[model samples]
Target: MTEAAAPRTPGSPCWVSLLVHGMGTTQDFYADLFGWEFVPGPDQLGPYVRALIGGKEVAGIGQLPPDRHLQVAWTTYLASDDVDLTAEAVRSCGGTVAVGPLDAGESGEAGRMAIAADPGGAVFGIWEAAAHLGTALAGAPGTPVWNELVTRETSTVCKFYQTVFGYEAEAEVSADFDYQTLRLDGRPVASLHGVGHALPRDRGPHWMTYFEVADTDEAARRVVELGGQVLHPPRDGASGRVATVADPEGAAFAIVRSTTAG
Candidate 1:
C-alpha cells in the first residue's frame, strides 16, 4: 500500500460517503461499532437506513437486496454538482456505471448520485448534494472525514478519474508519501497510489472510509465488544493509529483516530 500524506492543506479532505461491502452485512453492524442511531424508512425501492453525525444527517448504511451479489467493503464519496453528467462521464471513460443517477431523496439528502467502479477496479462515489451538504460530523470522532485509494496502477486510475470527474490530474508524486492527489480548480479532490499485485477479488479495488475516534485503542476494544473482528489490529499508520476490521456480518472497513484529522 502507498504511504498516506499529511493533510498538507488547510481543511480536512472532502469525503462524502464510505459505501463498502455487500449482502453479508446489515446496517446494524456499523450502527453498534460506531455508536450510531439508525433511522430506516421505506422508499420506492424499499427500506433504507440513515443516521446522524453531530445531530445532522451525514452518512448511510444499507444492504443489497437479496438478489444483488455485492461484496462486503466500504467506499468514500466526493460531492458533485451534477451526478447525471458524472454517470455519463463514467461510461465514456471505460468504467462501469454500477448504480444511480437515481434519486436518494429518501436518504435525507436531495438530488442524485451514482456509484461507479473505475476501469482500474476501484470504486468511488460521485454525489450531487441537495439539502445535505454531505456529512454532518466531519473530521471528528465516529464519522468519516477523509479517504484515499490504493490501486495497482496509479496512472490508469488517475486517467480514468480525470476523464470522468473533470479533474486536473496531478503528477506531483509526494516525497513523503507514494501517492498523487487529484485536483479540481487547484483544490485537492481525491488521491490515487500504486498497490501490490492484484487485490483479492472479494476485496476489490475500492475507496477506504476513515472514521474519527478519540482513542484508537478504545475504538479497537469497542469493535470487539460490539462483535467486530480486528483484521489488521491497531498499527501506526502515517497519521495515527489504524486498524482493519470487519463487522459481525463480514463488512470490511478501516478505522483511525488522528490528532491531526480535523
Candidate 2:
C-alpha cells in the first residue's frame, strides 16, 4: 500500500466521501465489503466518520440531516491550495458552487471545502487541506484507485476544470471514444468521458469513484450479499476487471482489480 505522507498535488483527487440517510447500515455495509474501520470526525456538517484501512484514512461517510434531501453518491474531492479562489474560478468559468468555500470541523482543522458543478452538471468537491490531508493510504484493497466524470461531452466540462484547477487535458485518440485524462505535474489525476445518451437517466452527469479490490468478481458478489445491487457485472476494461455497484441506499461506485495495483 502507498502511504500519502505528503500533501497531494493540486488538481489531483485527494479524497472521496458518501453522505447517506442511515449511518449505521451504511457503516455496516462498507465495513463488511471493504474491511474498513471507522473513526469519528468533524460534526459540523453532521455525524461523520472517516474510514480507515490499515490504520490510515481512506474515505469518509456522513449522515445527512433528516430534513435535507440530497443524492446519495460518492463525492470526489480534488486537492487545492485555496478553495475560495477555486470556487471563484468555478463561478467565473460558468460553473456553479453549490456549497461552501467554508471551514469544516469546529476548529476548522478538517479543511476548507466547496462543492461545485461543472458546465455539464457533474458535481465534485474542492478541498484545501489543513489538519486533514484527504485520503491517506492507497494502492491497496479498499483504497480509491480512480476518479472519473461521466458526462454528455468532454469539451466544455474539460475546459471548465482546466480553467479552475490548471489541469492539462490529454484527449484519447480514437474515432469512437470521447475520453480525456486530466493531468497534474505530468501525471494523470482524473478522467472525463463523454457517454452521450448512455448517461444514466437518474444519475445524469456525476463523478464516479473506483476503489481497488483484490478481485472484482468477488467484490461484486459480496456487494449483493451485503444487500447492495450490482449495477454492472465484472468486465474487462483497459485498466483491469471492473464492476459498478450501488450501496443499499443507492450510492454508486466502482470496484476494480487494477492492472498495475501493487
Candidate 3:
C-alpha cells in the first residue's frame, strides 16, 4: 500500500471515478467487494461520494443526472498542472473537450476538472487539484493499481497524448502486438494497447481501470456473488493474475493481484 500525500505529477494517472444510475446500490456493491467506506465528496457534479480505505481516499462514485443517459464506466483522470491549458492542448491535438475546465466544489476549492475525448473517442478527464488531491491511497488490495487505454491502435493516440501531456512513449518491440507504456519523469504511469478488431463494438475506445486484490480468483467469485458478472475469469497476464468483471449496472473493470505490488 502507498499513500499519495503530495501532488501527483502531471500526465500521471491520479484518480479513477465511476458514474452510475443507482448511487446507493453501486456504493454497496463496491464497499462489499473492496471493503471501502463512504464519505461525502464534492457535489457540484451530482450526488458524489469518495471511497475510503483506512480513512484514505481511494476512488470516487457519483450519481448520474437522470435525464442524461451515459455509460456507467470508470473514468481515469490524469493529473495536470493547469487544467485549462491542458484542455486547450487537448483541443489543439485533435481531441474534444466535452465538459468544462470549471471548479468542482461549491466555493471553487475542491479543484478544477474537464472531461475530454481523444481523436479516437476515448474519454478521460484532466484534474488540477486544490483541496482535493486525486487518489490519496493506492497499490494495496482494493486500491487502483493501473490505468490502460484500450484502443484500435496505439501509434496515433500515443502521439496525441505525448503531444498534449509530454508523455514519453515506450512501445513494445513486436510486429504481432502493439502496446505502449506512457511514462512521466522516467516512471511508467499509464499504458496504451492497440487491440484492432478485438475492440468491443458496444463500447468503443475507452480507458480501463484495474484495482488490486489479494486473490484474483476469489475476487472474481465475489463479484459474481454480489449481483455482478465475471466478464473474464481470472487468468495470468503480463502484470499478474487478473479478471475482468462488471457491476450490476454493467460497468466493467478489472481486479488483479499485481506482481509488482509490495
Candidate 4:
C-alpha cells in the first residue's frame, strides 16, 4: 500500500492542490465525488480552501487568477527543508522557478513554498513544512496515493530531479513501458514515465496525481456521470486496475486500486 505516515522526508511528495477557475464548482465536484469536506484555509492562504478527508486535511483548492494563461491542474508538492535553497537547486538543475519561495500562510503558520517546473515543463511545488505539514492521510479512498511525472524529455527530467532532490530511480518495470520508480532513503516515493508516444503530439509535460479508490471501473463510471470525462478506460496494470480521467474543467488525474505493495 502507498500508506504514508507523518514526518515526510525531503524529496517525498507531501501535498497536492488544485488550481481552478470555478472554485466553488470544483470544490463541490470533488467533495461529492470523493466525500471530502471543504473548509477555509489560513488567512494568508487567501482564496485557497483546505480539503479534508475524515476531518483531516488531505488536499487543497486554490483559485486560479483571472487573465492568467495557466490551466486548471493538480500540482504535487514535494517536501523540502529550505524553500529558497531548493529553488536555487531547481535552477541549478535546469528547472525554472514559476512562483515564489515565499511565505505560504500567516506569520510562521505554515512553511514557505515555491512553484517550479522541470526542464520538460512539468510543474511541481516545494514545501518547507513548519506548523503545517502536508497531508496526514494516504493509501485510502479520497486521498492522493502516488505522484508521477509523464513527460517527453524523460532523461532530462530524471537527471534534473535526481540532482535537485537526490532521488534514486530504479527502472525495473520493463524497457517497453519505460517506467522508473523514484525513491528517497531507499523507499519508493514517486515515479517517472515517458509517455510522449502515447499522448497527443501537442500535449506537454505534466505531473499526474493518482488517487486510490475502492474500484477503478466504478470510479470511472461515476466520473462520467458527474460530467467529467474518462480519458482512459479501466485497465489492469502492474500496480492495479487504473483509469485516467479529467474533471469538468479539464484537469486530468488518475484513479487506481493497487494490488502490489506500493
Tell me the number of clashing residue pairs for each predicted model: 8, 0, 0, 0
Expressed as tens digits, the lDDT of each residue in 90-146 for candidate 3 is 999999999898999977698999999999999999999999888898788999989
Cα RMSDs of all predictions? Answer: 5.7, 0.8, 0.8, 2.0
Model 3 lDDT on a 0 to 1 scale: 0.94
- By TM-score, the better pick of 1 and 2 is 2
Of candidates 4 and 1, the better by lDDT = 4
| Best-to-worst ranking by lDDT | 3, 2, 4, 1
* Local lDDT at 227 for model 3: 98
- TM agreement with the true structure for every prediction: 0.80, 0.98, 0.98, 0.94
Candidate 1 has a TM-score of: 0.80
Worst 10 residues of 1 by lDDT: 1-10
Off by over 4 Å in 1: 1-28, 41-44, 106-109, 168-178
**Candidate 3 segments whose C-alpha is farther than 4 A from its true place:** none
Clashing pairs in 2: none
- Prediction 2 global C-alpha lDDT: 0.93
Candidate 4 C-alpha lDDT tens digits along 164-202: 999998886556676778999899999998876675454
Question: Candidate 2, residues 109-220: lDDT per residue as tens digits?
Answer: 8889999988887889999999899999989999998999999999988888898898999999998899999998889889999999999999899999999999999999
- Looking at candidate 4, what is the lDDT of residue 215? 83
